[model samples]
Target: MPPKSNDIEAGQAIKRLPSNAELVPHAGKITMDEPAYFGKGIIKDLKTTVGTHWRQEMTNFNQKTVAVSMLMFITVIAPTLAFGASYSTATESHIGAIETILATAWIGCAYSFIGGMPLCIIGSTGPVLAFTTVLYDMSKNMDIPFYTFYAWVSVWMLIYAFLCSFFDLTRFVRLATRFTDDIFAFLIVSIFVIKAIGDPFGGVDGILFPFDPNHKTHQNQDADYDFLQVALLGVILGFGTTWLIFYLRSFKNSSFFCSDTMRSSIHDFSVTFSVLIWTIVSKVIFKDVEVASLNVPDQFEPTYQCCDDACTMFFPKECPDQAERAGVRSWFADMADTNGKGWVPIAAAGPAVLAFFLLYLDNGITWHLIMHKSNNVHHGEAYNYDLLLSGCFNFVNGLLGLPWLVATTVPCIVHLNSLAEKDKDGNILHVQETRLTMLFSHMCVGFSILALDLLKLLPLPVLNGVFLFMGVSALPGIQFWNRFLLFFQQPSKYPETPYTKYMDKGRIHLFTIIELFFFAMVFVVQNIKAVAVVFPMMTFFCIPARTHLLPRIFEGWELVLLDGDIFEIQEWIDRKTDSVAEYEASLRGDLSEYEDDATQ
Candidate 1:
């Protein structure tokens, strides 16, 4: 019999029907005959679980396949070409460039592949490259052994990285706002522009001097001609490659292959192919182009001895004994100098600590924003864990006396979002599932790096094309007009999320404009570092100037509109104070009475 509606609601519900009892029983008695059927069902589910998920993920991964491939190429291959060229150009030795490339590639494979944050292409970054250049210069000036110092620094960096992971230091990423990310990104773009533009000109003083009419052509002919040729070729290729990747990836869709996986991969590949091809072509066309090669003194022969047909350190090689060899101006001098018995060094612990923290904040914020765009995604809680892994990797690289690595902004975001799926409400679906492909890619990179000869065949121009593309791709983020209006006047339209009445997209928009403007200044004026000082000062003045003066100029009621909207502001304040009022008050009671009277 059916229960009355009142009885059901009042908690006097009737017993289950006979049909319902058949469908679901309170208890069951296990029978030996039923074991086979239950076992089959369990086995079937287990077998199908991985298979079902994998198909969807692969389909998603391939959607934006071309773009993803291009990004990978740009991230990995383009830098490989640039590093080789830069080292050769700077040192007049191809071997150093080659060795660094080999080492970086070997390490980068682990970073690019095993790293938890997908789309972060690992290789020689701008700062790390700059540091390497510094190391090289210091080595030349001080007459110190290069490889030994490198090894020493590498060992210590590993120790530092391990400590970072053990302590779980990635928790600080939560405070990082769009402001911090933009600052770092602005800096990164500035650095890239500086290096790209400055490298060709050879610094501030040398730009017009060599090209002056009165200069003797015989003395400077080879050097000037070579510099111009390399510069022109590299710029065209790097920029072109970067552009192609961005162009291909922009054609996003809800269907398969347009998703995160392929889009990012294609973008990487475009960069890689651009760079790699240029390198190969450079070698072929300008045999006298005097480009660099990686062949160097074998690590095993001079530093180690062959024992039973395998390399083994003979003596005083890995860790040299006595003071004379220890203090050489290599990257590892910091470690030896720490004990109070080594050579003169630059800013020690403070700069490195600050640099690491800045890098963490910069990467974490950008990653969070990009990750949020994905349909299927994990919450930011896992960011700490992932960042810990990245930091650990960086620390390990540092110990190798290698350059400290970082998680890049664009690639990481593009990779994850392209791979994500969305539910009916447009919420992101399963994201953690992309781990399989990431693992496979890492394995590929690791094995590929061992073939140093094949890697050397890559060209520089293609890489340049890719570099230019990446820089150009970031331009859209600038939002110049939108930023200008927000900066000068009260925002007519403001971004809003459900929890907050108003959100500031202006920070990012302004930062991007500032970054592009800085890049342009560096390109044109050729003295970018001068702007760094200017930026901090401007930020200081603008923030204070607006906060204090703007409030006074506008009335309290006007201020509400200026900040957001009056109703929205009041609603937020009321909700926040709902639990905190000392005295009970019915502020909305009067309004409710008016509404009731109006209805009557």
Candidate 2:
């Protein structure tokens, strides 16, 4: 009798295995052919990396790049200013807005031309900020010049970075499973969300409605100057910006749009359009109301204004009356000004070691997430090369007394998503991989120093909305977040992912619970200033927990189902099928032997 149609189809499907070349290396596995020691790995990386360096920028230049550039300009600048302000408080204005802008511009420009992954946006992060604050406190306690000690630490860090790159130590980044990436990504998203709507219920310093509740109205005060009206208008602008962007983004699929191209254009330029519209609304339409604007420097100068001869290494002296204090510090940091402590340079290595690990984990994990198979980024990764570049840039930044920069998680995710070409269902078809957006956006940041007045017109609430949008937009693609939402969902109506289809519901929730625990630990540690310098080390610990500890709790197949990428899941399924076939064949042989003995 002939086989049934379904049987034939199943047989054909079983015969069709994916080619070896088609398999994507699992995130938790190291599959590179280059030798780990010496410079061979770097050489191999550069062969693919250097060749495509120019093509990434020159090819695929389009209108989307321009829109993305403007969008990213706002995205990158807002955080730069925000972090810069934090640094001013943390480091006593040594690394302020101008320093951050300069570092971002110069480093961004250099990396665009030479970086292995141009899409990864480099900026200062919270962990780095926390570490800097700790280092400053240490410097004060030791009675040493902060910038001088900072410069020596960076010098040692540079050496360590080069050595790591040379030895291909960055290959360990492959051990960062989705478990780690999701937690890190979520942490960044949480930061954005919190910063956007800080104590919106009552706090006067809230970003959404920063009206002082303590203000008492005087008889001479203008009746039009109502704090309630100002607060309400600010809320409108903030939420209005977020709503407009999301509405326009959805307009591409809306039936009201006449042309698909027009709808798509509006969607692509949604962020830029929203920002411009809200800025005009705040500055022009509601000119009478005083909303908080972006705090930018009035001139292109150092934030710590002091006359050159007035300030000493240990104690800052009062500035001379009527003298320009902007150029007090020189471009180069004085490493020798260590308050007569000859052992300072040698002792700097201790902090340098911590900074190295911090940068390594920060840069490595972010690159791994960005290069994940789902993102559809075809451009090759340059983990070793990019690390080297970061070390080099940070070395320069440190010498110039600027805050250290690394691959900022939120901004990089935002940049990647912005350039991605997605379908109606939000699957990435292609990312418009280009250097132009990073190059252009950062250049605008550099130029903004001259146009600080223009930037001041942009209300802080509008940026808060942008921050809210960024955090919300990034949430859709995170698998952990999707699984997290499943906790609230009915099992019968659960979305049918591989894990859902194969694994038990209880098992799925257990895996999520474990991941949540790790995330919570990292979050708690990061918030506690006394132990926050260990943030990167704690983040790196997830690798061992995923690789060694997770296996004991879940079966191999279950782990693959829950945490593995698309390719890993497919491979695991194939292996399981083969094992089942072999087991069934052995049972048939045993049964045949028993039947022969019975016949005898």
Predicted structure with the largest TM-score when compared to the true one: 2
Candidate 2 lDDT, tens digit per residue, 1-600?
633323433223122333322333342342443446787666766767767556746566788888899998899888888888878877877778888888888888788878888899988887888888988888989999888989998999999999999999998876787888898899878877777876332232345444555532212456566777777887898888889999989887888768988887998899999999998998899988888778787788666655555355212435445434444566788888888999999999999999999999999999999988878887788888788889999999999988899998888999999888787667788888889888888899888888888888889889999988999899987888999999999999998777898778999999999999999999888777788878878888998898889877876667777777777887866655654554343433333443365599
Give per-residue CA lDDT, model 1, range 64-161, as digits (tens).
Answer: 45434444533554354455455544443312443444445555555433344444444454434444455556555655444434434444444444
RMSD of 1: 15.8
Which regions of candidate 2 fall more than 4 Å away from where they truly are?
1-35, 199-206, 209-225, 307-310, 313-327, 573-600
What's model 1's TM-score? 0.51
Task: Go through the candidates in order and give the clash count of each.
Answer: 90, 0
User: Model 2: which residue pairs collide?
Assistant: none
- The TM-score between candidate 2 and the true structure equals 0.87
Q: Residue 183 error for model 1, in Å?
A: 3.4
